[model samples]
Target: MTVLEQTGRRPAALAGLWGGLALTSGVALTATSGWLIVRAAERPVILTLLTAIVGVRAFGMARPLFRHLERLRSHDSALADLATARTEVYAALIPLTPARLGRRSRSAVLAGVVDDLTDVVESHVRVRVPVLSAGVAALFAILLTGALEPGAGVLVATWSALVVLLARWGLALEREAQPLLGAARAEVSRAAELVARHTPRLQAIGAAGDVLTRLDAAHTGLARALRTQSRGRALVTGGVLVLTGVTTVVMAVIAGRAELPSAVTALLVVVPAALADTVLPFADAVRAQARAEQSRAGVETLLDQTAAVADVGRGRQSSTAPHLRLEGVSAGWVEGRVDVGPVDLDLAPGRRVGVVGANGSGKSTLLAVLARALDPASGRYLVDGRDVTELAADAVRELLAVVDDEPHVFAADLRANLALAQPDASDQDLVDALRVCGLESWFDALPDGLGTRIGSGGRGVSGGERARLALTRAVLSRRPVILLDEPVAHLDHATATSVMRDVWAATSGRTVVVVSHRHEGLDAVDQVIDLTPTRKD
Candidate 1:
């Protein structure tokens, strides 16, 4: 789907028309001022001078009026189109979410997508407006000058064409430098991220200097790439200034040679100078176009894949006590490679299973499969004696609640955060879930109980509270199966143990599978399965 504004063409065109009128008013203002000054010097009649004064005042007032209208129309159109484009891009992004977003932190990938989408939408205002306004102004100047003096009109047209050629060249230069600039910036970011995240490890390995040297090198490269990018803008600006000066002088010569009146000649001579303002903004517009193109390409590349899991099956619901079984289920984030599984397991109702493994053993990947966030490469994932692939992914997902290490609490009141799991849940239900998940004491301490704000920019929550809040969501969801993928991984040993005790208690009578690389709370599980990845052929 095209994220750029296609449907709002009429409004954009109307905005451009207003912009053209504003620019035309400026051109007329300049020309009429020159004529009025020349006519006054010649001691023209009071009546003639009166008309010139009124014309100048009219043009001056019209310029700002048209400009205001242009801004209102253009901004309203751009904002409406931006809203639509963002919605389309976000909808496209939903299916590919966590599984296809790669192994890097989801925040970084998602943040980049948001930035690119904004850049794409901004093209309408930055690139389209300037181009259309310049076109209108240039066309008016050429026609008005050509009517009085064809030679002057040809000069104006040539200057406009040269300006366009220079802009195209600058755009090409900017495009060429884009990939190099991106690579250099990415290298700098990588170096900085490495230093920030692993400073102690690098220092311990006695490689801090080397990492610093690499970081310095990355910065140097980034500076060099930036210099290269600026050349395009410089070329467009310098070339346009030179061309405008030449056009203005030529316009004077043509007006001096023509048989027009002295006042009219003065008007003709200054027309090119007035139109210079219309053409000079092309440099910035060209650069915005190049950036928008790059951003659009980046967004397309990031989203140009089939979803990792298909969701085309019938929406089948399971019993209150669902039985989840994974038989030889192997899956990977990328194709043709197995990241986890080829193991067998059975989860009857209310059975608690603990999954333990080293970092690369695919403990989280197993939980993802059980939660229907991933489809197995080979083997069956059965829910209530039926292959899960036969059921809609969302339907299967609804039967399960999966909590990961990082639980996000939105910036809202205490009750609003839990209500997302059960949108129609009552105040008593919310209070009971929080009480069951060991947040009773914390809730009571709140100044406003359910109305107490939490999450970002709100009240701060401890690591233990965050974990319990996630449990409260699961309890509120009332899903038959609870899947915990390192939910307590961030907590200390004692906190992790206490949180797990609450987790098990809150999820009573529900099938539970907890995956952990650490052994903080494995003792409470009914069965602890140690996952060791088998070597591939």
Candidate 2:
């Protein structure tokens, strides 16, 4: 979690070693460059000697640069792994108190990937590269100046402060831009979430225009904020040029009259630009700092939520293994009231069962609890003669699949959609899956076959097809346990019958618990779990 740490550590202790090597190499590049300029000022003999010395610095840098690149690669891989680790936290955080994450979470995560990660890489590189390069460059510059004339050495030292000042001025402008840009991105995230959450209600009420109004307002705010930040960054750049020009003029005057020859004068004056370039990364660093703060806080929140719900406080499983069981598993539809089911229960493996209920019964919540997608207020869940607490939840998730009443079909081709369930599935395997789901003909008849791209949220497909497709994924996985909350709730008579037939066929030897309002859908099931709604005042 402490991404930027410098502890005596185990994971990639080589980060420090890489940092040192990169610093050493960058210094050599700077020193070589300055020496080449200084030596070229003298006669051919001196020029020849200076040129070789300059070239030596280049050669000296090669090994360090190679090692540093390896380090960069290691750190980048570490960062990516960290991202994967954070994703697990997000998965764990959902189904805690809330039902789903803010849709803005997707874009926020993307921003962290697209811009925030870049900020870390650039910030580290900038902080390392410039200081090392300039330090080496400045040291050589001073030595050359002192040898030529003490007055020139003193002048070089004086102008170094001006360069640092200019860097600070540029940094201030960049600092302001970073926060403004961060604010704009946050607004965009919030607006995206608002729209995703309200889309269903908006369609129901024909109030889509109101959703557009919210979107437009958020976009307008973001656009205005970005423009302001862009203008500020532009101003900083202009200031950099002005500062660079003034120093060049002052140094030019001093070098032109000094006893040192033209080449030495050039080295004394021209080399400062490289030094200036060194500190330039600070402007970028400022923005990185702001974005990193926002992302890190987001990650922290996610981790904290994970820690809060962890089974650490509960006892581990020992005897009396129940394929599934829940104790004190209480939660509610509307926070304090309408709560249901602290029911202690158990089920056997490979048992087919039906969860029957009228509207508002706690049937669906029970399915969620068994799926490990929802946590009970307090409970013990056993799977496969072992306590679930004994397994990493992520690994446990791989063991079960759910077919919700409404399922999301990615805006992707048929093959791509199926691949989400099993990325390495063969073509024939996909064809077999389609066949089992009664969708093979529908897919094969398409102009693009499995390559036909569906519209967003299955726009180009019918609701029944979407339902079947989602069911297909769960069926194909053939997980140890399958929870079908409402596999055929939206299908018409004939279509529902076909889907239900396949459901029964595929689940022949699997453990399955289905929840459905359709009596016909459950007529063939082993036992019916009757969860009638409690009468309300």
Candidate 3:
């Protein structure tokens, strides 16, 4: 379902009401100011003009006042909707987490989701409220003009229709540009993120120039898309002004022929000019609508994916340490493309296994299947001799602690960061875990020790430190089974070897599986599984 459909109606209604009032006030202000000026020009008595003077002042004041309220109501409603939509989207993504998200560049896909949600929710404020407000103001304009003269009313309605048509044309243009704009933006984000996260490595390997060239190309594409999208808004903006100028002249001519009073004629001529603010926003609203539609489509498509693994029931929860086994297991991340294994594996309690393969050999895919993030397509995956498919997914997940390469370090205190893995762990327990993962020196160097803030906007951590921190978290969790997917990939050979030594020491009695393309950490494993493709024929 679209984010707009899920938003609360009451707030939307309140926003519309305030918006309508604000727009109506603007129209009234323009019309009254014109009438007051023309009446004064007639050399009427001051008392005769008092009512018009008061109306002009009232409308001028009410316009800003109502507009302020409209902004408050609309923004508040949009923010509330944003919060709810984010919560729902996060929940919906749990089952599809690592597997269905994609094999590579998952961070970019997830980032796109975040951006899309913001656009979808902002539609209420940018498109819906403005459209409603403009509609109300237009209706008031038509009714008031009709009360004065039916012919003028007909002219106003016709002008309003033309404005709508212009808006529709703009919307069509924006809709055509939306996909290109969205794709360009996503590409830019992915390329920028890659460069930002791995600049040093790229430079060391002499690929920095190549990566930067790609980033420039992505930025250029994004700029082109944005320029294309803006053409629609430009057309509508110019159209509205031209239409308003023409309508004002037509109204002036109509009033002259009708022999209306000078004040009434002035009001009629000013009506079109007054409505310009109301109709001009239609261009922006159309663009917003197009963006929201594109965003909604992406969000819905991702959320619509069938989970990689389904929860059968709340199956058996292991009371003691769990034993896992994969029999003739072949798992594919995307349907119809087998990425990993048609091999047998057994892990009794406390066994350490290392999985090694070159790129595309599916070492990570095998780890994913073991982590139960992906279900095996053609094999029996059993935990404690019970099929994992029969057991509750959460129950199986509870037995494993996973540390992947890009482990997030939240912008929080060192204690809070470690506490996420084991919320009930004591500070001393955290320190112990950190020490075991070879972060003892780093922890000691912290100005506030466990209380020191880290992650973004805090103390800078090195790549090796980040890897160790992730291992610390896994050690703190103390789950029986630990899955490490290149947890030490970012570190140098010596550091990777040292971290693996610490890993073996810390997870001494736990069932563990480490997946890496590098051989640096293989020495600590009880057994190594090589997934390099071999010709059978």
Candidate with top lDDT is 3
User: Between candidates 2 and 3, which one is better according to TM-score?
Assistant: 3
TM-score of each: 0.95, 0.68, 0.93
lDDT of 2 by residue, 124-180 (tens): 443444344455555655666667667666666766666556555645655566666
User: Which clashing pairs does model 3 show?
Assistant: none
| Order of candidate numbers by TM-score, starting with the best | 1, 3, 2
Q: Write the per-residue lDDT of candidate 3 for residues 448-513, one digit (tens) a residue.
A: 999999999999988888988888888888799999999888788888888888888889899999
Question: Which digits, one per residue and each the tens of the lDDT, describe model 1 over residues 1-537?
Answer: 565636457777888888889999999899899999998999967897998899999999999999999889888987787788778878777778768887657778878877777777667777777778888988998998899889988988998898889999999999988889989988998999999999999999999999999999999999999999998999998998888888878888888888788998999888878988887887888878788888889888878878877887895874778888888889887889998878799899999999998888888888878877777999998888888878988888888898888988889998899999999999999999999999999999999999999988889999999999998998999888899988888889899889988988898888899998777767878899888755699
Q: Rate the local accuracy (lDDT) of all candidates.
A: 0.86, 0.62, 0.88
Off by over 4 Å in 2: 2-143, 146-180, 189-209, 231-236, 256-259, 277-281, 307-309, 312-323, 332-340, 343-364, 379-399, 405-434, 443-466, 486-497, 515-535
lDDT of model 2, residue 45: 74
- Estimate the lDDT of model 2: 0.62
Model 1 clashing residue pairs (backbone) = none
Candidate 3, lDDT over the whole model: 0.88
